[model samples]
Target chain A: MKIPKPTIKRLALYYRCLNRYREEGVNFVSSKDIAERLNLKPSQVRKDLSYFGEFGKRGLGYNVVKLVDELARIIGVNKVWNVAIIGAGNLGTALANYPGLLKHKFKVVALFDNDREKVGKKIAGIPVFHVGDLIRLTQELNIEICVIAVPELAAQRVAEIAEEAGVKGIVNFSPVKLRTSIPVEDVDITLSFETLAYNILKANPEMLKLIEEQ
Target chain B: MKIPKPTIKRLALYYRCLNRYREEGVNFVSSKDIAERLNLKPSQVRKDLSYFGEFGKRGLGYNVVKLVDELARIIGVNKVWNVAIIGAGNLGTALANYPGLLKHKFKVVALFDNDREKVGKKIAGIPVFHVGDLIRLTQELNIEICVIAVPELAAQRVAEIAEEAGVKGIVNFSPVKLRTSIPVEDVDITLSFETLAYNILKANPEMLKLIEEQ
Candidate 1:
C-alpha cells in the first residue's frame, strides 16, 4: 500500500503509544488524545489513520488492539528485524540498549565501534566488534539493516560500507548528511532535540524564568 | 502563523538540509530535491513551504539562503536555546555529547542524574548534578527546555517535577507513557527506531534476501 511519507511517520507514533494505551486499560482512543500526546492535531491524526481504513466508530474512538495491529501491518513492523549498530559510542550503546528499539518487532544483532579497546565488549547483550569487522559480521549474521550512530565524519563512509555489505536498510544517527540509494534513513539527531525544546519553549516562555531566577 | 503540523516537521528537515545546500555553494534548490532527502513528494514540499512567504520563485526554484532564513524564522530556531538535560544515564550523557544538539540553536546547560557517582562529573562540560537539585539549578540557569532521558518509570514523575520547577518542555526517551496537562512533547523512543526500520523494511524487502546472499 502506498502511504504518504507523513502518514508513515505517524504510524510509528501510533504504534508506540498504543501499547501504553492498552496498559492503561484504555480500550478506545480518539484522534485528539493521540494528537495531544504527540503535540499533533486531532484532525491530522484522524486523517492519517483514515488513510488506511475506518478503525474508528462514529461516536467512539479507535480500538487500541485493532489500531495497533493495523498500524503495525501498515508500517511493515509485523516481522522481526535484526539490526546492526555501527557506532559503539555512548549514543550507539544507548541505541543498542534502547528499550524502544527492541519493543516487539526490532532486534539488535551486533555493534561495531572503531575503538580497539571497546571492540568485543557487549552492550544490552549485543556483542561489539571493530568497524573493520562490519562487512564480515554483517555477511555472517545476515544483518539487513544498520543503525549508524558513528561520528559525523564517519557517517558517509559507514553508510558506504553498510551498503556494500548488502545492508537492506540503515537508521543513521550521525548529524552528517549521507545518502544511499540503498534505502538508508538518516535520523536528524540535533533537529529533533531542538524541536523537543521548541515544543516546551512555545508553550511556556515563562519557564525560562526558572533559569533566570537560578 | 498556524501551519499544518506535517509542514512544521518537514520544515525542520528542509532547514537542516538547506544549510548544507548553502555551504556547498549551491544557491538554488528545487522542491524536488527537498522531497528526495525528506522522502516526501515534490508537490508536498512546495505546498508546505507555500504557507510561509514565497522563498521559491516560479521557474528558478528556492533561494538557498532565503529559504533557510524563512524556515529558521518559521521554526523559531533563529535564536539559541539553553537546554537542560535531566537524567544523565546512557541516554542523557550521550545526548549531552551529541554533536547535532550542540549545533546552531541549542546548548546543553546542565545534566541531572540521581546517581552519586555521576553527580559533580561533567559530560562535555555540562556538569552532572543530583536530580534533587534540578528545581533549584534550572531556575538559576535559565534553561529553556528539559530533556527527560530517565527510565520509563521515572519519566512522568520527573516531568511533573520539572514542570513544577519551571521546566517548560520535555524531550522524553522513556518507553512508558507520560501524562502531562502542562506543555510536554514526548518522543516515543521505540516508535522512532521502529518506524525508521519499518520504512526501510518495506522499501527494500528483497534486500533481506540479498543480505543473506552477501
Candidate 2:
C-alpha cells in the first residue's frame, strides 16, 4: 500500500508513543489516549494506522505491546543498521554521540572526514576514517546508511561519494539540495528556527516593526 | 493573512533559494525557476507567493532582489533573534557552534545547563549559564527563543521553565511532545532516521526477513 509521507511520519510517532506506553507497563490504550498524548484527533491516529492494516479493536482500543512490535517491524527498526557519518565536524560528532539513534537500533560504526588531523582520531569510541576510504571501508564495514554533515559546498560531493560507496540511504544535515539516486532525508536545522521566528512575528505584529527598525 | 504551516516552511526555503540566486548574480526568475530548484510545482510556488501579494509581472518574472527583500520581511529574517539553548550537552554545544543559525540571524547568545561543570564554561564563545538562572538571564539577555536540547526526561520541565521565563517561542529537539502556550517547532532527529528506514524497507522487502531474523 502507498502511504502518504505525513502518515509515514505519524506512524513513527505512534511507534514511539506505543513504546513509551509499553515501558510504563500499559497493555492497552485507546486511540483517544494516543491522540491526546500526541495532540491529534483520535480519528487521525486510527486512520493513519488503518493504512497498514486493522489495528485497534472496537472497544479495547489497541494492544500496546502488539502495536509496538508491529510498528517496529513496519518502520524497519527491528534490525541494527550499520551507519557512517561523512563529516567529523561538531554536528557530525554530536550525531555520532547521540544516544537516541542507538536506542532505536541505528549504530554509528565509523566517521569519515577529509581532515587528516581528525581522520585518525576517535570520538566516543568510533573511529574516524579519511573520506577517501569511504568506498572501501563502507563495503568492509557493511555500512548501509550515511549521514551527511559536511559544509554546504561539500555536502553534494560527499553524498555522491557515499552513493558510489553503495550506501543505501542518506540523512543530510547540510542546507543544500542534493541530487542523488539514493533515498535522502534532509534535516534542515536552521529552517525550524526560521519557522518559529515567523510564528513569533505573526503573533506579535508589533515585533515586526521593531525587527524592521533594527 | 493566515499562511499554512507548510507554506511558511516553503517560504523559508524560497528565501534561501533566492539568496543563493542573489549570490549567483541572477536578476530575475519565474516561479518555474524557484519551483525547479526546490522540486515543487510551479503552480504551488505561484499560489504560495500570491498569498502575501503580487510579485511577478505579466511577462517578466519576479525581480530576484525585490522578492528577496520582500520575503525577508514576510519571513522575519530581516531581524536578529537572540536564542538560548536549554542544554549544554553535545547537542547544545553543536547548535551553539552551528554557523547556519548566525547566518540566518538567530544568534545563540547563551546556553543553559543543569550540570554545574558545564554551567561555567563557554562553547563557541557563548557563555553557559546555570539552568537556575534561566529567567534572570533570559530577561537580561533579551532571549526571544529557546532550544530544548535536554534529555527526554528533562525536556518538558525545561520547556516549562523557558515558558515561565517569558520566551516567545521554542525550537524543541527533544523526543517528547511539549505542552506550551507559545509556538514550538520540533526538530526530531531520530524520527527522520526511522522514516528513512521505512522507505528503505518498503523498497526492499527482502530486507525485512533478514532484519527480523537478527
Candidate 3:
C-alpha cells in the first residue's frame, strides 16, 4: 500500500519528537502527549501511526526508545545515506556544515561546484570537485542523494547532472523548480515564511485588508 | 471557513507556478496544467482552489495574471512583511542574502545575535542587532515576523524572545523544536532530506531491509 506523502513527512516529525522525549528520559509517551507537544490532534497522531501498524498498548503509552527505533526503521533512516551537495557556495557550504544531517544519518560526502577556485578545496572537510566530475564522484563516493543549492540559473543544469548521475533523490534549496524523474524535495525557505505570513494574515483579516488598502 | 494547512502550502506552490507561467507569457492555465506541473492531481488542484472561491472559467481555464494576483493576495504576499533573523551565523547570513525572500515580500529588516562582534555588523545591508534589544527593536522597526536560525541550544530562547516581542509568526530554521504561543513554521532542512531518503528507500524496500539487517 502506498503511503501519503504527508504521512511520510509526519512520520519523520514523530520520530524527531520521540527522540527528544527519549533524550529527556521520558520512557513512554501517550498519543495525547505527543499531539499536545507537536500541536497536533490526538486523533491525527493515532491515525498517522495506524498506517504503520499497532504501536502502543491500549492503556500504556508508547515506549520512547522502541517507538524511535521503529520509526527509524520504517523511515529507512537506520543506515547512513551518502549525500553530495551540488553547490559549494554559501547555502551549500552551510548545509555541508549542518550538524543535523550527520545526526540524522545523511552524511555529506562531497561538494560539487563549477568554479575552478573552489575545486580541490574543502568545505567542512568535504572535498569540493568540479561539476564536470559529479557523475564520477557520485559513483566513487557511492552517493545516493544530491542536494541542489546552486544559484537559480544553474539549478536546472545541476539537477540534470544529478539525475544523469543516477542519484536516488534530491533536496533542492534553489529557487528554481527542477523537473526530473528522481524524487526532488524542495526546501524553499522563502515559501515557508510566505505560508507563515499567510497564516498570520488569515488570523487578522482586518489587518490584511488594511495593508492592502495602504 | 478554515483552510487546511496543506492547502495553504499548495496555494503558495500554485502562486509560484503561476508566476513562472506568467513569465513565459502564458495567459491561461487549466487545472490539469497546474496539477501536472506541480505533480498534484487535477481534482486536488480544484479542491484546494475551491476553499477560496470559484476560479477559472469552465472551458477557458484560468487567466494566469489574475490567478497569480489572487493567490498572492490570498496568501498575504501582496505586501512586504518586515522580517528579522534571530541568528547571525552562516545559515542566518545566507538567509539574509537570499533574494527569494525579497521577491516574496519578506524583507529582512534586522539580524539579532548575542555575539558582540556580529551584533553591529551588516549582512546583505541589513543591520545586526543585539538579541537583548529584540523586543525594543521589534517595536522600533515594526517587525512582524521572526526567523529563528540560531543553534539548537539557543533556538528556544530566541523563540521566547520573538514571542515576547509580540511577533505575528515565526519561521524556525534551527533543529530545535520551539514551544511558543505564536505560530511557527519549521523549515527543518534535515527533515526534508530525510523525507527524500525515506521516499527513495520506500521505492527500494528490499535494499531497506538489507540495510536494516546489517
lDDT of each model, Cα atoms only? 0.77, 0.90, 0.88
Candidate 1 lDDT over residue span A25-46, tens digit each: 8998888889898778888888
How far does residue A181 in candidate 3 sit from its true spot (Å)?
A: 3.3
Per-prediction fnat values?
A: 0.50, 0.83, 0.83
Candidate 1 lDDT over residue span B52-119, tens digit each:
76778878899999888777765667767778888887778888887667676788889988899999
C-alpha lDDT of candidate 2 relative to the true structure:
0.90
TM-score of chain B of 1: 0.86
At residue B42, candidate 1 shows an lDDT of: 92
Query: Candidate 3: where are CA atoms >4 Å away?
Result: A20-36, A41-67, A114-122, A129-133, B21-30, B56-66, B119-121, B132-136
For every model in order, what is the number of clashing pairs? 5, 0, 0
What's the TM-score of candidate 3 when only chain A is evaluated? 0.93
Cα lDDT tens digits for candidate 2, B51-165:
9899998678999999999999998888889999998887898898788899999999999998898878999999999999999988999999999988889989999999999
Residue B148 Cα positional deviation in candidate 1, in Å, after optimal superposition: 1.2
- Chain A vs. true chain A, TM-score per model, equals 0.81, 0.93, 0.93
lDDT of 1 at A118: 86
Residue-by-residue lDDT tens digits, candidate 3, B103-178: 8898999999999988788989999999999999989999999998888888998898898988999998886668
Better of 1 and 3 by lDDT: 3
Chain B only: TM-score of model 3: 0.92
Q: List each candidate's DockQ score.
A: 0.41, 0.57, 0.64
